[model samples]
Target: GGGKPLAPKNANNAAKNSLRVADIGAGTGNLSIMLLERGCEVVAVEPNDAMREIGISRTKDKNIKWVRATGLESGLEDSGFDWVTFGSSFNVMDRSQALKESHRLLKPQGYFSCMWNHRDLNDPIQEVAEEVILELVPNYTRGVRREDQRPVIEQHKDLFDTIIYIEEDFYFHQNIETYIAAWKSVKNPYWDLETSEGQELFDKIAYQMRHKLPSEFDIKYTTRCWSAKARN
Candidate 1:
């Protein structure tokens, strides 16, 4: 699936009220960069060395502290953050433990938000791409089932009284070259598919898709975001 840019919203509402913010599993600091641009004191927790390096290099001018830590053990002080965000990284951790840790680190009324840029399976091309990836990487875990969001929210209802959950579709325009480059950026299943056979399969799929394109293609994306606050 293509890595679509996050939509702008009232995120600053939470940021403005908070004195410090931390982005968990901040791969290459995409969301962290935005927070910095918004003038928030931001810290990024990323365990992967290479990914952290990329983020550090990208945000050289911005004031972003990078820490090598997982979701459950962020190595941050207790009640240290007023806002904590997980952009496209919530599914990678033990959700229950991560939620608990988030609650622990957040001060009273602090917000915990999670966002994901998912492919709209309803789109034909996206559906085909999903099928291709599934067949190619059968062992890969299907991260973040779409239907489970409501249940997750229910499980944490007591922790957060005021909840805002939303899913929206966004469209991205890209040419074949840009599309391929975007695809290569995806880790895990795509990165694992570095073998000759995998390359052949990806090339074949890209070629087939290119023939159907009219100089450019519209990639549909579904972005799901959930925000809640730690009750006092």
Candidate 2:
């Protein structure tokens, strides 16, 4: 038994009380919950069924609406939101199209933001993990998520202005089991996990994590963010 899923509050009321935000590709609603806790009325959009299901479950008690949609084509109303955000999901989208959609969703001068939490591969433990993956999956790539986002965001100067970028490093401590599970959730498009080589790579990583690492360890990460306001 849960309360009714959060619906969009009245426009004037939302504008008076808080910001209305569209969280595109809101995997598991992590960022949505954060926004909700900070008094924003959030609409969380996710295209994948499994991920959306988990997201709905996670935010059932929170006041956040979950929508089935993609970042490039979120089926939200025009000029209805004070902010549009993509949390670590922007790299998977066509940046140009996504920016257009975000601009369409934002109110006048509303903000648009995309951010990623990047693991510090240079960390001692992470370095070993990376070496293991590279040894097995020789073609492993970090993809666009690691690349600088300024050039692409700047490309859409017509849609947005006043680009603001920030980066900060932090550390998280977790058990070996939890860390391994986190790795499993990262589905790399190029990595053919059905192959025997893929299985071996995972098995080897798990073995190394269980044997080589301590029960609980600190992992370093940098949170990178880019934001801009609607041009018109």
Candidate 3:
């Protein structure tokens, strides 16, 4: 839920040594950590102070450069990175601006990728959770993360070439506490947790989750990704 773990199809390419990567909106360095594990040189850009601090603390012993920057303005060197990636962060940015920034930050023919781990709503466990959400907010939508990114990337045809899309299903096993914590971290577009109604909605969802979910269970998710080569 809270965790966004991605296993790319091109495992060999990902593990190539000395590959320079810029992880935009790199919240708490999840993607950055993965990249480092694969022997990558990472520039993690996160604008949020709290998240960046945690990221720094988490990777203090590792080789990483953390910068305070947004997806639309990474302030990174031009044509410096072999790959520019956004892990569950592209939706929060202006997609067009972010794409331009990605183009600017990557070497000619370098790759640009953005991905999100989406809960499998068709899963039995997720169906129960969805029931709770729709009951509270009937007009609730899954938001931009679920949308196809091809059209937007295609719009920048001058900046990027043909897109490659990947969808892979995986299961994450976790305790109820961890699962609930994931929900807490989520930014639900339909409800504001700062408001009383939002609090009530979360409480209700939590209560139902506690009632419905086992202490330990597996949640199904599909990691959807879109990538393309940046053109000069």
Best by TM-score: 2
CA lDDT of every candidate:
0.75, 0.83, 0.84
Cα RMSD of all models vs. native, in order, equals 6.4, 6.1, 5.6
lDDT per residue (tens digit) for residues 49-140 in model 1:
87899899999977678999987899898888878899888877778788888988887888888888777778876666666556655665
Give the range of the ten consecutive residues with the poorest summed lDDT in model 3: 1-10
Best lDDT among the predictions, by candidate number: 3
Off by over 4 Å in 3: 1-17, 191-204
- For residues 66-105, what per-residue lDDT tens digits would candidate 2 score against the true structure? 8887888787999998889999888887888889999999
Clashes of each: 0, 0, 0
Window of ten residues with lowest summed lDDT in model 1: 1-10
Q: What tens digits encode model 3's per-residue C-alpha lDDT throughout 1-232?
A: 1111233345465544467889998988888998888767789999888789989999997769999977887778999988899999889878999999999998887889999989988888888878877886799787788899999999999999868899999999989888887776565565567779887778887888888888988989899999998887
Q: List the residue pairs that clash in candidate 3.
A: none
- Over all chains combined, what TM-score does candidate 1 have? 0.76
lDDT of 3: 0.84
